[model samples]
Target: MSVTSSDPRIAGARAAPKRGIRFSWSDPLFRAIIWQIVIVGIVVGIGWYLVHNTMQNLAARRIATGFDFLDRVAGIPIGESMIAYDSSVHTYGRALVIGVLNTLQVSVVGIILATIIGTLVGIGRLSSNWLLARLTAFYVEVIRDIPLLLQLLFWYTMLQGLPPPRQAWSIGDTAFLSNRGIKLPLLEWQTAYGFALLGLAAGIAATIWWSRRASRVQEQTGVRPSVWPVAIGGMVVLPLAIWALFGAPLVLDIPALRGFNFQGGGTISPEFSALLIGLVTYTAGFIAEIVRSGIQAVPNGQWEAARALGLRHGVILRQIILPQALRVIIPPMTSQYLNLTKNSSLAVAIGFQDIVSIANTTLNQTGQAIEVIAIIMAVYLTISLSISLFMNWYNARIALVER
Candidate 1:
C-alpha cells in the first residue's frame, strides 16, 4: 500500500507535447491576409480586363481620348458672369467656370434664405398657438410632398404669364415687383466706397472679437453680456457710419419705363427668380423637419431648469436648447444644402444657364458625350466632397464624446 516517490502508472501514461503543424491554417491573422489577397486579385483582374476592353473599343470606334476638348471653342453664351464671355471667344473651361459660379450663386443664397425660413417655420410648428402650429405643419407637408420639378414649372409659368414691362407693377417709384420678377435700384460706386468696405470689414473683425470676450466674461462672472450691441454694431451701425462718412459714395439708379421695357436698373430675370424660389421653398421643408427633430431631442428638463434659473424664453432657447440641438441639426442640414446645390441643375429646364445646361450645349456641339459627362460628374463630386468634409468637421467639433 506504500506509494513510490512518484506514481509510476501516472508518469508512464503522461503524454508528450504534440509538435505536428504548430501553425494551423485556420489562424485568424493568416486567414485575413489570405482573404484580402484574394479580393484584391479579383478586383485588379476585373479592372484590367475592363480597361483593356475599353481601350480596344475606343480604338475600333476611332474616338480619341484626352483633355484636349477643353481647349476647343465652347460656342455657348452665358447669362450672367463676372467676366465677358461669348460663344466665339470663350474656351470650354471658361464656360464651365461660369456655370459653376452660377450654381454657387444660387446655392449660397438659397441655403441662407432656406435656413431662415425653415428655422422660423420649425419654431412655429412647436408653438403653443394652435393656429401657428397648424399653418407650419401644413407648409411642411405640402412642400415636401410635391416634386421639385413641378414646383419649378409652376413658378416659371406664373412668371411668364405676367404683363409686359410697360405694365409691370411699380413699388413707390423705386422698386418694381412683377410676375416678370423683382427689379431694384442699382448702385453706382466710387473710390470712397472702397474705404467704407474696408472699414466695414474691420468692424466685423472687432465684433467677432468682442463676442468671444463676452462669452469668456459670462463663463467667469456668470453675467451674460448683451449680444445686441455687437450684432447691431456689426450689421448696421458700422455700415451706416461708413456710408455717412463717405457721403454714401454711390448713386442709385432706378428703373424707368423706356420704350417697350424698363431700363437702367438691375433685374432678377424671370427664369432665375423662379429657379431660386423653387429651390428655396422645396429645400426649406426638409430643413424644417430636421430643425424640429433636433430641438425635440433636447430633454424637457433642460427647459425647466433654464426657467428655474430665471432665464427668459428667448435666452433659454438660445443658451441651453439651440446650442445642444445644433449638434444634431447641422449634419442633416448640410445634406439639404448639398441637395439644393445639385438641384440647381434643374435650372436648365427653365433656361437659367447653370453648369449642366452649358455642359449639355458643349456636349452637343463637340459630340464628346463621354468627356462632357465625365466633367459634369467630376464637378458635382468635387462640390459634394467639399461640403461633406466641412460638415463632418463641424459635426466633430460639436459631437459629444464619452470617456
Candidate 2:
C-alpha cells in the first residue's frame, strides 16, 4: 500500500507537531525555573521577617545601631597592645587595629612553631622504631584529648607561680624565666638595623631560590642535593654578613638586676606566654594526625618501586613520598590554619588583648555591641579569605595533573 497525507498516521506526523507545548516535570529547564522561584520567595520572605523583627526588638530594647560609635574614644585600656594604648589618646578604630596586630602576632608565630613540632611528631609516629611511634602516639592522644582553654589556664598558673624576677632562673646568663614570664636579651635598634633587616630579606629570597633549584635538580637527575649548607649560609652567614656590614647595630639589652626587678631586656607577659604555648600545643596535635594520614596514603607500591630504583629511605621519603603526601596534607592543613587563627579569639579569656578582646572592651565601653561584633566578624572573614586564597594558589601549584 502507498502512504498518503490524508492517512491518519501520515496526517498526525505532518501536522506541524501539533503546534502545542506539553508541560512535563521531567523537563530540566521547567524544574530549574520552579526551583528558582521557590528559593527566591523563601529567601525574600525570611529576610523581610528578620528585618521586621529586628526593628521591633531594637525599639523594645531602646538600642540604637550605627557605626558612629567607632569614632568615640575607646576609653577602655588595652593591656599589652603593641603600641602605647592608654585610655587617653586613641579612637576605637585605632585600638581595634592594635588588637588585630596582636592576634596576627600570636597566630603567625604559633603556626610556624606548631608546623615544626607537628611534622616531627608525625614523622616519629610513622617511625619503624616501636619506641618512637608509641611515644609520639601517646603525646598526640594526650594533647588532643584535653581542651585548649584548660591547657592555657594550666600553663598560665604554672608560669605565674614562678619565682619573682629578683630570683629568676637564668639559662647561661642569656635568658631569664620567672613569674614575670621569659626575659630575653633584645637588640637595641639603631638606624643601621634597617640594613640588617634587608639582609634577612635577601637571605630568605636566596633560600627560596636555592630550594627550588635543588628540587629541580633532584627531579631531573634523581640525585638528592644537600640542603644543610645552603640553610646555614643563608640563615646564619648572610645575616651575620649584613650585621657586620652595618657595623652591627645591635647592642645586647641584657637583663640586669635592678633593685628588686630585672631591667633592660624584653619581657613576655604570662598571658602571651600561656596563649602561645596553648595554641601551639593544641593545634600541633591535630596537624600531627593530618600529616600521619597523608604519609600513610602513599601506596606501598610507591615505596617498593623507589626501593627497587636503589633509593635510600631518606631519598625515598623526600623525593617520592613527601611530594605526594603534601598534596593530600594541604587541604586539611588550610582548615587547621583557619582554626588556629580564629581560636586566637580565645585570647580574651586570659586578657591577651587580641582583636576579640579589644572588641569586647569597646562594646562594653561604647554600648555598641552590634557594630563591634560586626567589625570582629568582618576582620576574621578577611583573614580567613586571605589564608584560603594563598593556600589554594599554593595547592594548585603542587597538585598533580591528571590525564
Candidate 3:
C-alpha cells in the first residue's frame, strides 16, 4: 500500500472513508413527507373551493339545504316494494328504504344464479364432448358481445308480449305465466319459521366445522371422510327435522285467475324478471372466462401427479385442481360480482324502482338534487366496500403461502 501505483482503487483504499451526504432533499423519507403534504394541501384547497361555490349558489337561489326533505311525504307510488308502503303515508326516506331492499333482492339472487350458470359453462368449455364445448364457447361469445341494456329491454318486451291472464300458460294450476307476470305459490311464514331459520343457520355452522375437521383427518390418515353426506344431513335433514318439530309452520298460497288478473300468490313483475335475466346472463359470461383461465393456469404436472396417485377425475378436480384454480379465480370473480351489483342500477331505465330510480324521483319532486345524489353515492359506496371487504377476506383465506 505504501508503494501503490496511480490506480484509483488503491488510492481510494489508502484514503480515509468518505462520509455520506446528510439532510439532503434526495432522502426518501423527507421526500415522501414533502410530497404527502403537498397532496394534502391541494386536496383541501379543492374541497374548500367546491363547498364555497355550492354554498354561494344555494344562497343565491334561496334553496334550503338539509336532510329535512327526507321526512316529506312521497306522493309517488312504487311499483314493487318489499315492505308495506303507501304513497300518502310513507316518507321519501321510507321509499328509499324500499328501493334499497329491491336492489339487494335483485343483486343477491342474480349473483347466486350467475355463479351457478357461469361455473357450469366454464366447466363445459373444458369438457371432452365437442358439442358441449362448442355450445358453451358460442354462448360466451354471444352474451359477452351484446350490450346489457339492449338485452334487458329485449327480455322485458318478450315478457310483456306473452298471452294475457285469461289465456295464460299454467303449470298444473300451481304456476301461471302471462303478460301480467309469473305467479307461483307463495310460502306463508309463521312464528315457528324464525326458529326453523335459526336451526338452518346452526346447521350451516356445523357443516363448516365438519369440513375443517374432515380436511385435518384426510391430512393425517390419507383418507378423506364422506363430507357430502354429513354436510347434507346437517344442512337439510337437521333443518327439516327442526321444522317438523315446530309443527311444519309453512302454508302455501296458490295463485288463481280472478277477473282480469291472477290473484293470491307471489308475483314476479316483468321488469324485475327482465333485469334479473339480463344481469345473470351477462355477468355469467365474464365469470366463465375467468374460471376457464383459472383452470388453465394450473400446471399440467399437478394433474399428471394426481392421476399417477390413482385419483379419480372428480377427486382430482375437487381435491387438487379446484383448490389451486380458486386462488386465481377469486380476485376476478369479485370484480364481476361488484359489476353485477352496480349494473343493477340499470333497473332505472325500465321503471324497476331501484335506489337510483327512487332517488331520482325524490330529487325531482323535492328539488334536493345535491342531497339525493349524495345519498345515492353513499349507498353504492357502502355496498361496493362491503362486497370488497368480504371478497378480500375470502381471497386471503385461499391465497397460497410459501414456507
Candidate 4:
C-alpha cells in the first residue's frame, strides 16, 4: 500500500497572498477628493499672493483705503438727477445715489421700449407681405452691425446739432425740443394722487384674482369666460372713478419758453435722450432675432392645427403661439437686458453722469481708486444678479409641465 500524506502546513502554503495597506489609483471617490483639494489649495495660494501684493503696494504709496470718502462733500454738478442734489450741499454718497437712480431710469425705459419694438419687428420678419418682411430683415441687419457706442455718439451729435432754444421745435405749446433738451408737460402731484394710485393697484390685484378664478371655472365647466372687459373696467374705470372722486388731484404743468430755455415742466436732457435712443435701437435688433427664432421654433403643424380649429389669427397668436414662444424667448431676452444696463456705463464718454460716470469722478477726486472701483463692481453685480433672478423665476413659471 502506497502512503498518501495530506498535511495542514501544505494547505497553508497554498493560500493566496494577503493584500497590505496600499494606494488605490482606480477609486473614483478618492481621486475626486484629491483633485478638489489640489485645486482649492492652488486657488487659496493665488488669492493670498494677490492680497499681500495689494496691501504692500497700498502701504508703500500711502494710499488711504476705506469707504469713509463717501461722506465727503461732492462738489460736482450732475446733468440729470431724479432726486434733489446740490453739488455744494450733498455728500458723495448722495451724488452717487442720484447717479444710480438715473441709471435705473434709463435702463427701465430702454428695456420697455426695446421689448415692444423688437416684438413687432420679429413678427414683421415673418409676415405674409414680402415688403414688410424684407424691410424688417434690413433693419435687423443694419442695427445689429453698427457699434452701439458709435450709434450713441451719432445720436448725441444729431441732437446737439438741432435748433437752439430760441428756435426750439414745438409740438404745440405743451412740448419743446431743442439742442438743450426736450421739455414736456408734467403732472403736478398731490396727496389725493397717492390714494388714487393705491386704488388702481387694488384694482389690478382684483383683476388678477378674478382672472385666476375664471380660469379655474372654465377648466371645470368647459366654458371660457371673457375676462378682458372686466379687467379693463377694473384697471381703467375704477382708477378714473377714484381720481374723480378725490377731486382730480393731478394738474398738467405745460412747458413754456422762458428767458434762455424752456421751463415750468419736465425736461429730458440731450445726454439722456441720446443714451436711451442708442440703447433701445441696439438692444431691439438682438431681441427681434430672438423673438423670430422663438416663434419659428414652433412647428408649422401648430399653425395648421390652430387654423383647422377655426381660431382667428389674433387669437391663435395671443392664445397659442406667444405662450409657447415666450419659453424660448425669455432667457436670451434677459441677457440682452443685462447687456443694455452694462452698456449704459458708456454714458461717461458722453457725460450722461450715470453711476459709473459719477463713481469715476469720485475716484479721481479722492484718489481712492480701489475703493471706487470695488463699489462700482458691487453695484453692477447686484443689478445683474437681481435681473437674472427675476428672469429665472419668470421662466420657471412659464415652462412646460410634461407628465
Best by TM-score: 4
Across 1-403, the per-residue lDDT of candidate 3 in tens digits comes to: 2535888766654442343333668654456568899999999999999999998999899998999988989998999999999999999999999989999999999999999999889988998999999999999999999999998998888988999999999999989999888999998878777777787888889889888999999999999887898788878888788889888776889999888788899999999999999999999999999989999999999999999999998899888887899988999999999999999999987779999999999999999889999999999999989989999998988774511
> How are the candidates ranked when ordered by TM-score, highest leading?
4, 1, 3, 2
Best by lDDT: 3
Per-residue lDDT of candidate 1, residues 1-403 (tens digit): 3435377754432321232222445544455567899999999999999889977988799987667988987777777664678879889989988888888888889989999999988888998999999999999999999999999999999998887776778888878876657789998877777767787787788878888999999999999788778877876787778778877666889988788667788888888889999999999899999999999999999999999999999998888898899988998899998999999999999989888998898888777777888899998999888989988988887775410
lDDT of 2 at 161: 90
> TM-scores of all models?
0.84, 0.82, 0.84, 0.87
Instruction: Write model 2 residue lDDT over 1-403, tens digit each, in one string.
Output: 4446478865554553355433666644456568999999999999999889987988799998788877777777776777777777788988999999999999899999999899889989999999999999999999999988889888888888999988889998878998877889998777676776677788788888888999999999998688778878877788788778777665888988788777888888889989999999999999999999999998989999999999999999988898899999999999999999998888888779999998888888778776788899999999999999999998998984510
Reference-based lDDT, each prediction: 0.85, 0.86, 0.90, 0.89
Model 4: per-residue Cα lDDT over 1-403, one tens digit each: 2224466554433331243323565544456568899999999999999989998999998999889989999998887898898899999999888888888889999999999999999999999999999999999999999999999999999999999988988888788889999988998888777877887898899889989989999999989788898788888888888888988776899988789788799999999999999999999999999999999998889999999999999899988888889999999999999999999998987889999999999888889998899889988998899989999998888885411
Cα RMSD to the true fold for all candidates = 8.5, 7.4, 6.5, 9.2
Model 4 residue pairs with clashes = none
Q: Which residue runs does candidate 1 get wrong by more than 4 Å?
A: 1-31, 178-180, 209-248, 257-260, 400-403
For residue 85, give model 4's deviation from the true position in Å.
Answer: 1.0
TM-score of 4: 0.87
lDDT of model 2 at position 291: 93
